[model samples]
Target: MKKVVKFGGSSLANAEQFKKVGNIIRSEEDRRYVIPSAPGRRFSSDTKVTDMLYDCYHQAESGKDFSGTLSNIRERYDEIIRGLDLDLNLDDEFRTIAENFKNKAGIDYAASRGEYLNGRVMAAYLGYEFVDAAEVVAFDENGNFDDRRTDKIMGAKLDSIERAVIPGFYGAKPDGSIKTFSRGGSDITGSLVAKAVHADLYENWTDVSGFLMADPRIINDPVTISTITYREMRELSYMGATVLHEDAVFPLRKEGIPINVRNTNKPEDPGTMVVESTCNKPKFTITGIGGKKGFASITIEKAMMNAEVGFGRKVLEVFEDSGMTFEHTPSGIDTFSVFVNQHEFEPHEQQIIAGLHRNVHPDMIELESDLALIAVVGRGMRRTRGTAGRIFSALAHAHVNVKMIDQGSSELNIIIGVENRDFETAIKAIYDIFVVSQL
Candidate 1:
């Protein structure tokens, strides 16, 4: 069973953290492919190498003296090499980086240096060959990841090498210009590598042992989810559970490759296993509770709305034309409401209101802002009776009024909209009803 192991920035923040990662990788022979992110914070007050690189790049861009910032970044890496006792000197690499920064390489190039530099350190420490991501990963002119081309190249490249360490996050465009995925995109790079190599498992080593049932900030020491299906994970991720990169699951989802979200500091823990499908029953009725704030709702009531053809379409077209996207559109025979990001909808509210009048010509329109949507998602929910009842009961007990509730047809998730002030209270109440009670 081959495994593609990707370590987060925190996992390789310093020489000591590097030692821990080296042991974890060497512990298993199946772990032939290693992906490393740039050094992260060693302490709470420390700045990450990625952030430092960004600052350094900005200084160069503004034609300011960047030598001091660049020197500080060098010291970070040099400290790690010294701690590892590696016979390596990166003076030449720094020189090259200095030249590139002076040449005004784009932000993507600047952002990627963290991963690139770390990969070099990791390779030296592990005595493995360092494979540059730019040579294997591909992006198009539009800067979107070229999946097919990347898989073909990355797969073929790894097949020949017995073991290799590839840097995460940034890839080269067809023209060979550096392009990066969004922040926390190292997760995407790991998924892509797992897909390319057709590894049986992708082990993402980070600070957390696994995904939690609720946000720890709201619920203290929440239960760690042992197993979560891809669909369940995606729902939770979309609703704001960010244990893993939401988009990273796409490539592995198609290949049916499972991901193991293991904690770097605690390697003995199995962490969470993310699969396409699983036979294991969920320990709780709800797999996870995830939600977000800053939403608004638009309700339009037109008599006999269900009888009118394309009424919903006309209403939605207004939002689309105005460059706005609606989250949920719960409807009734005479009315339907469109939920959208309040921040995105505010500037265009007047235009949308006028468009609704001209297009659908509703009898009445109601607008409400400061809403939050919480999703209680689980595959086990399909088999459980009165899951929604239990949720509302918990919320009602907490004196949180529900503004809107929508249960997906698959019974995989129930989305509850509440006043923004009640968001945390509602989640705690639901957690108590489902997870806390069971425990």
Candidate 2:
């Protein structure tokens, strides 16, 4: 059984952390394909290598003297090399990087160096061949990832090597210009590798032991989720839960390969397992609770709104014309409401309101701001009855008012809208009912 392991920035911050990662890899023979991110913070106050590179590049772009910044970044890697007591020297690599920065080779090139240099170090430490991501991961001229070309090339490339280390985050455009994925993109690289190699499992090692049932900032010592399905994960992630990049699930889910989120510091803990489907039952009535703030709701009331043909489409067209995306729209026979990002809506609010008046011609249009949407998602919810009632009961007991609630047809998740002030309280209430009480 082959497994692809991806280590996060924190896991390789310094030589000591690097040693830990090396041991983790050596412990398992199946963990052959390795992916590494740039060195992260060694301490809370310390700067990450990637951030330093970005600063250095910014200074260079501004035509300012940036040698000091470049020297500092080099020192960080030198310290790691010294600690490891390796014979490897990065003088040539650093010289090339400095030259590229001086030539204004683009921020993508500067940002990618973190991973590139780290990959070299990791390969040297592990005795594995180093594979440059730019040569394998394909991107189009528009800077969009070309997954078809990437998979074909990556698959052939990996099949030739028994063990290798690939840097994550950034790939190359067709013209060889560098392009990076959004922040936290290493997760995407790992997933893509797992798919290309057809690995049985993708192990993502980070600081956390696993995904928690609720955000820890709100609920003290929240329970960790042992197993979560792709659909449930998507719902929780969309609502703000973030152990892995949401996009990472796409490639692995397509191949039916599971991902295990493990803690690098505490290797013994069996972290969260994400899968395509499972017959195993969840520990609680809900899998996870996550929510975000800064939403505005627009309520449109018209007589016999449900009976009016194309009424919903007309109302939505106004938002589309305004270039605003609606998050959720729950309606009744006479009234319907559109929920959207408050900041995005504010700029186009008057235009959207005017369009709604012209297109739908509703009797009344009311706007409410400062709303938060909470998702109570679980696969077990489909089998359990009164899930919505339990959520309402919990909120009512906590004295938190619910502004709106929407449940999809699949019965996989329930969305609750509340005032921003009550977001934390509502989440705690739901956690107590579904998790704390059970424990």
Candidate 3:
């Protein structure tokens, strides 16, 4: 029945939200551990506490008077402490943070203080023990997460305390330098804790209730995915779904721990349950669909290319030498195509083209800009037939030309390439084909 709950910045933005979190924590005895992010934007126009800390560090680095900015951050925590009516004296911690700022703590260290300070306030409000992440979360010499060491340390620490609040985001390196996860990385911390404790559920409390079938702005009132597999999540996330941190998936997936994506504002509604596998049927034609535009494809055609050995390897070596990664390589007997981000290839386009000519010796090389990739991912697609046929029919009906198509062996996803201008029309056509026609 144990659960490791993590809250995003939006969930811990203000004193009222803090109170809501306290109630949620107090209601469940097994919700023994908590992880929090820096205070997020209080309103649309305001800057987040994390952003403010970064600004303060930049000012301090530039030898500017940043005391006012630093104090505002301290007051945000102080106001939360006062509103909670806690007797905790945070002067020492505040002084410690201020001294670090004066001495020029790295940007990661400065940014992490928001979560550290907030963890203290939250612990006092809930009457739980405060466990600083820096002490327990370990990083190696290279700054990669030391999962083995972290699991051992965190598990032993939690076993000693009944309830605790652990700040998220940054951990300490071997030399005590602060190293942070990418933004929205608190989810990864929560997942690591869940795996260490073997919790029954890992709850990610954020602003949204659950994941929608498609981008809301594009498809109006799209259906929500009630249950999704880890594989399905990866596909959708790769296609630009933003519900859960992709890096956070593997830790829990390895231990078979299910993650519940829920809303702090609407706790009563059962949010999406991300599990290993489920027999529950989807309410929509596809689980989710999303895409990113602005990609460029390199088309290389060579007669009798299949007759040559190591041709593909030689071509790919050029990309590696240029420090570029290929997204997809769809090939025919005599032709091969490499797709990559347009922005990434823009700088090295001429070099890449020249390298290809020198190494692979293609008959013709052409570059197509303003390309977009759309992914239609679902487990239901595996059970149903003619999925590809239906997709092509829909696109043809809408007059949206398909540039390239790649379907993984898992059959969980099918990515279609289209022109950037035709991106919206393509998605609408496919969604209507599978979703609207069924209705």
Candidate RMSDs in Å, in order, are 0.8, 0.8, 1.4
Residues 170-275, candidate 3: write the lDDT tens digits: 7899899888888888888899889888889999999888887788878978777789999888888888888889999999999999999988888886888999
Q: How do the residues 204-297 of candidate 1 rate in per-residue lDDT, one tens digit apiece?
A: 9999998999999999999999999999999999999887889899999999999999999999999999999999998889899999999999
Q: List the residue pairs that clash in candidate 1.
A: none
Q: Could you tell me how far off, in angstroms, the CA of residue 341 lies in candidate 2 after the best superposition?
A: 0.6
Q: Could you tell me which residue pairs clash in candidate 3?
A: none
Q: Which ten-residue region of model 1 has the weakest summed lDDT?
A: 181-190
What candidate 1 gets wrong by more than 4 Å, as runs, is none
Candidate 2 lDDT over residue span 1-439, tens digit each: 8999999999999999999999999999999999999999999999989999999999999999999999999888888888888888999998999898889999999999999999999999899999999999999999989999999999999998999999999899999989999888989999999999999999999999989999999999889999999999999999998889999999999999999999999999999999999998998989999999999999999998888899999999999998889999998889999999999999999999999999989999999999999999999999899999999999999999999999999999999999999999999999999988899
How does each model score on TM-score? Answer: 0.99, 0.99, 0.97
